[model samples]
Target: MIHRRSGSVGAGAVDGGAGWDGVEPQDYDDPSLGGVRKHELIGEAEGARQYRMRYFEVPPGGRTARERHPHDHGVMIVSGRARVTLGSETHEVGEGDVVYVAGDELHCFEALGDEPLGFVCVVGPRSAS
Candidate 1:
């Protein structure tokens, strides 16, 4: 087995300001999806040949697209709160909370309270596999 440690520089705004170092926020295809921005922390840019790690942030009152795919992924809330819908269950999630999304399970996140919701997401890089 190969043991690997990810190294990424730069500061990420938990509340608001700028994105992570060396990584630019991704522009969504549909702007109507709300103020959602994703920052790739560890992926091809860092020479990782497996999974990709990203940080997503949505402004207050914003939400993500409700969709599902044939891939399982994980998320860890870094800041703020949100009402998350996974499959048929909906619940409020906040900072430090961890969530697992199964393959083909529909999920969405809606920012709640006064601050933007930020979270770390990890998924297998499609190009690598």
Candidate 2:
């Protein structure tokens, strides 16, 4: 389950380090899976009622776990290159490229360049259960 924190001040000016002030980067790996660090840009604490924005960095030779969720995702490459697997197809993506992963579609991302693969992902709100 995901946890929500209160008191976020929203975005910062500098995009260097692929991070912003007030936001902390955390491991995106699950005990059952591994690879990737993530920073939450906007969420419930930031007054977002419908969506959340996050940034992910996958180091070279690293990859996110192959998994599927019931939510859709809007992903945009921010830096470096990556190979994104969506469903049965895999494609190369670079900075400025955008990808859409529909709900329940299996997907994963692997860093392909010497540098880390950085990307922004926007996800729809989760139901309160």
Candidate 3:
């Protein structure tokens, strides 16, 4: 994964003046697998760090399989809603809500609204397995 900086302007839209540049939105290809699209924010960070943002158009009854990551992941809801199941605990996430996933924890995500659910995902450096 190539670690790409979000450019000058970020989510907070800070003003860096003259040379300030904004991060361009990149699209993820997944037309064959529903309408799931991922826009990577920060691919590879300096040293041991990684960050990414993803958008999903999950269909009704659609759900992500249980998966584990070697790094701690954090997610912030931007639009719509979702039912995130982390182990035996399930919670609803909506706009302005942030969810954190512990490293190596079993987790699953599901769309909880009639429309597609979109969110930003940020992950830390991957720990040795």
Candidate 4:
């Protein structure tokens, strides 16, 4: 199920309060090993057609499929270690590391540590293709 919170910014209003409370927990299991979980936060801001945020937990040695998005992405590592490949650069990301990947860039991630690697993903302008 998709869930979201709405916010409004009136004219001359400096602070647009109450934007995105939180989303209910939803599991995204890998079809292969069935050990990983991904909790998604689908963005719903009034008129925006496409916006999403996801919390991913990649199990040890687990990897994601090579993919591309129609819009930009902001990824922040929360815990453990992750090997992120954005385009041609592959780097190790840990806690507090943030990566920005532009639109249509081929990217993938793999859990490099013994524990589960967690990260927050923000994607804009969902693709129709």
The candidate that wins on TM-score is 1
Write model 1 residue lDDT over 38-125, tens digit each, in one string.
7777887678777888878787888888888667789998888889999999999988899999878899989898787888889876
* TM-score sort, best first: 1, 2, 4, 3
lDDT tens string, model 3, 36-125?
445444544323344444433344344555677777878877656689988789998877899999987888777664655666777764
Model 4 lDDT per residue over 1-129, tens place: 434445421211112221234544443544764445555565554345667777666667877767776789899987668889999999988878999988889898788856667677888766732
Task: Give Cα distance to truth, residue 77, candidate 1, Å.
Answer: 0.5
> Which ten residues in a row are the worst by lDDT in model 2?
6-15
In angstroms, give how far residue 9 of model 3 lies from its true place.
18
Off by over 4 Å in 2: 1-17, 31-35
Report the lDDT of model 1 for residue 107.
Answer: 93
lDDT, residue 68, model 3: 79
TM-scores across all candidates? 0.82, 0.81, 0.62, 0.69
Candidate 4, 106: how far from true, in Å?
0.7
Q: Each prediction's Cα RMSD?
A: 5.0, 6.5, 7.8, 10.1
Highest lDDT, which number? 2
- Order of candidate numbers by lDDT, starting with the best: 2, 1, 4, 3
Q: Clashes per prediction?
A: 0, 0, 1, 0
Candidate-wise lDDT, in order = 0.75, 0.76, 0.56, 0.66
